[model samples]
Target chain A: MRIHVQNPAGTSAFSFTRAQWDAAVKRHPDMRDLEVTIDNSDDGWSAALPVADIVLTWVDIVGAKLRGCDLSHAAPRLKLLSCNSAGVDRLAPFDWLPRDIALLNNSGIHADKAGEFGLMALLMLHNNMPAHIRSQHAQRWAPMHATTLKGRTLVIVGLGAIGGGVARLAKMLGMTIVGVRNGSAPHEYCDEVVSVSDIHKTLVRAEDLVLACPLTKDTRNLLSRERIALLPRGARVINIGRGQLWDQDAVCDALDSGHLQYAFTDVAWSEPVEEGHRLWATPGLILTPHIAADDRDRYNDITLDILFENIRAHAAGRPLPNQIDPVRGY
Target chain B: MRIHVQNPAGTSAFSFTRAQWDAAVKRHPDMRDLEVTIDNSDDGWSAALPVADIVLTWVDIVGAKLRGCDLSHAAPRLKLLSCNSAGVDRLAPFDWLPRDIALLNNSGIHADKAGEFGLMALLMLHNNMPAHIRSQHAQRWAPMHATTLKGRTLVIVGLGAIGGGVARLAKMLGMTIVGVRNGSAPHEYCDEVVSVSDIHKTLVRAEDLVLACPLTKDTRNLLSRERIALLPRGARVINIGRGQLWDQDAVCDALDSGHLQYAFTDVAWSEPVEEGHRLWATPGLILTPHIAADDRDRYNDITLDILFENIRAHAAGRPLPNQIDPVRGY
Candidate 1:
């Protein structure tokens, strides 16, 4: 089988170096027997696509005009379009994807990274790290004591790979997890599982709220102004999912009004938040520029692992675990 | 039996309220049979200590003159002196205590709180939160990605109550715990246990270093300038122990030089950190005002639990579990 690996042009966070590829090959020796080609230029894609049976890429390769390449006529043998990202929300509407080629995402690869980040976010919010950080900026020596998170309730929305990661770590930390998802399926990590329709009841008792779902039509602005108000006073908020998962303004207002004690969000409504954005100076707000889940050093390794696993499954006529359901738009 | 509970004169972190005392009594029902008197004044101590069989205090009641009251001459029935703290280094030298009196400390109560805080600090350091906070102060949207804590080496000094607490949590987070305490006895949570004398060997491999030992003659300035330099480049330092346990100036210098990636210190050489202290403006440094372990909401209740547990042990023939070894100064 022939495989084509297309990296994004210029310097990107997910850009893989040649050394990384070599290291990954050493880790997954099965790649040695395959015909592989790697490039970043559009010309390279034009050349490699025609002979490629499998293609691995970051989502940027797919756009309205398919990066101005005619993949339908060029890549006849392509059986897999593997994306090196957990969320493929930006690449919705599978009309551009050839029906013959299956799309697989790098989802479960982020579990360990998300789990650690989620726990850290929860602990930071509980211990008032954001406020303490603000105090440090002003050279203030204020000590705000906090209780342990032993019995605190967490209402985590979306029990997918990312949310499940947070749930596992949070449960281990002695928190009572209330998972909110599309269906009321019982989860191993959550103490109680409630559907999205029953989120209000869980919100009323939520001491901590985590957003770790995909940015689907139903999930956008899920935590609106009213829902923010429903959370008990001093509740902490964490958004590791897409920023559109909650109302950013409502979060800021709740934090400003002291209804929410603190908020830690890795994502923003807009990438690279412009100068003078209110979020930059918002009190009790820790804005981490969308770097919560990706472990830069191991991201490519894990992505390659996913790709290899899917390739093996495809070869064996088994269902690919990371394959995206086109109808779900995940 | 008469139990005198002398609280600090003003509002203190560990000061127990009347409601708290009543709550403690409710939790430990055996206390109902005893005559318990709670007071916060010099006059109250003068009247109560003379006839008291046990004393519960926040370590302020014992001075050179024993709070200007003679405990040996008046309090002949005093059998147990329980301090509402884990470390009794400040009250070292057992000359003031009568030979018949056994000193008990609130040690294990801090495990849960310390575990949470320790895990938070490590995560913050690993994720470069100190630098992120600095960027947040400048309203910069710089994203620094980090690897997970799994398989990372943690050289934790002092595997006592606080350090042990940190170890259990760190171990759960997939870190390799190398505990450094007074003895070389292996601990359950630590992958390897080393004595204080062999700390230099561990420092070279330490990706993260934690100071959680007591401030005794042997431990004062334990993490000296040379010791700090022994750590690998970009190593993170967390001091949740006493202020005197590590060299603060060395930590600041290392942070400034970029030899250390970040440092999260809850204690300082002299705290309330004073106006114009260099630590206030140090880059890549997070200085919290020494509120690391104490869960203020449950501190008094836990202290009462310790007191009751000790009281029960004293009633029986068994030795008080929290009783201090005078030679150890903790």
Candidate 2:
């Protein structure tokens, strides 16, 4: 079976080089036995698409209008499409995806990086690092005090790979975790589990709130202004999920008013935030420019590892762990 | 037993109020059985010190020329001096402390807070949060990449209560810990233990270096300019120990030259840093204004708990857990 790797242009961190592919192949030598093709430019896709049995591409290249790149038209032999992102939120309502092809996401690949970032964000928020950062920049000697994370309540929305990773680290640090997800299934890291409908009542208990669920019809604006008011004063919010998952203006307002002590958002309402945006200088807020989970050096390797594992499972007629459930739109 | 509690003015976080004393007494009701007298002024110390068998005061109260406050002459009845600080480096040589008096330093009280702060500083350094803070302050959307800390090497100097706390958390995060202390005794959290003499050679292996040793004649300027040069390029430095332990100028220069990726120093060469100090605006450096380990709310409770435990041990003719060894100066 032939696998075509699409190198999309203009994606800096996600753009994997040929050397990275070689390095990944060194880790998974069994891939050397299979037929693999790569393309760097727009024209290369026209040649690579028709005969490829599998496509390992970034999520950005999925709905692109490149010549002969349409999966339903030119890619007649395509059986699998592996995306390099944990959240396939953008490709939701997978109407563009052909019925015959199975989709796989790089889910667990980001867990390690996300988990570390999540832990860092939680600690930073708890310890009032954002205010200290502001004081440092202002050439002030103001000192803020903080309590320990132990015995504090953490209400995490979404018990998927990213939230679960955060929960595990928080649990190890001796925090009481209350997990909110689409379902009420208990998670090992969470002391208590509640469904999305119960989130309104759960917010009052959240000393630290983490948004890690996928953005979908049910999740968009999950933490609205009304919901933001439900959280206890001096609470912290960390968003490793999509930007649309929260009401950005409400977050900024809460931070400005000191209702929310601190908030760390790796994402923003819009990429490349506009000048004079409130988020740029919101008090007690830290903007990470959406670099939380993506590991620069190991992204390609982990993505390929997931792809290879999926390939092995596919050959053995077993289920793919990273396979997406289209009906759920994640 | 007569116990004098000296509450010094102007010590914001460390100053325990009467309400705090009552709260602590609620935690340890047995303390109420003893004759505990609190003095909040210079005159009060003079009155309480003369008749006191035990003195509980801030480290700042030591060596003060207050009338009837001299442990050597005015307070002849004193047998135990319980200080609120973990490090009694200032009261070294025991010249002022009566030879008959056994001193206790609040060591384990700060362990939990110090451990949490150390972990936060470590994560911040590894993830390059200093750079991100700069970017945010400048209203720039620059994105920097970072690797996970799971496999990194952390070399910590002064593996006492504070250092051991950092080690425990770092070990939980899966980093290899190399501890440098006065002795080579194996630490449960440390993968390897070495004496302070081997620190120069061990600095090369450190991706993260922590200064948690006590300030002493032997530990002064431990991480000097030459030793700082020995660290691997891009290594992060965390100074939770005394400011005198490291050559602050050398750290600033390393950060300026990009030889060091990041450094977090809660302690500074001179705190409430003078205007135009390089530490105020050192690139890739985060100056936290010396508030790393002190919990504002729980500080008194923990300190009182340690005092009560020490009192129990002292009454039982057992070795005091917090007693300071003057020969070591910590």
lDDT value, residue A82 of candidate 2: 86
Fnat for candidate 2 (0 to 1): 0.76
Q: Per-residue CA lDDT of candidate 2, range B63-92, in tens?
A: 464323455678778888888988888776
**Pairs that clash in candidate 1:** none
lDDT of 1 by residue, B97-207 (tens): 666889888888888998899999999888878877777778898888998999999999998889999999999889999999888999999999998899889999999
- Under CAPRI classification, how is model 1 graded? high
- Model 1 lDDT per residue over A1-330, tens place: 998888888777777667777877788897777777888888988899889999888876765325445667878888998888888888876666767889888988789888899999999988888878878777889999998989999989989888999999889889999999888989999999999999998999999999999887778899999999999998899999998888999999998999998999999889898879988889999888888899977998888877888988998999998888878887
List DockQ for all candidates. 0.81, 0.75
TM-score of each: 0.96, 0.96
* True contacts recovered per prediction: 0.81, 0.76
Residue-level lDDT for A40 in candidate 2: 72
Pairs of colliding residues, candidate 2: none
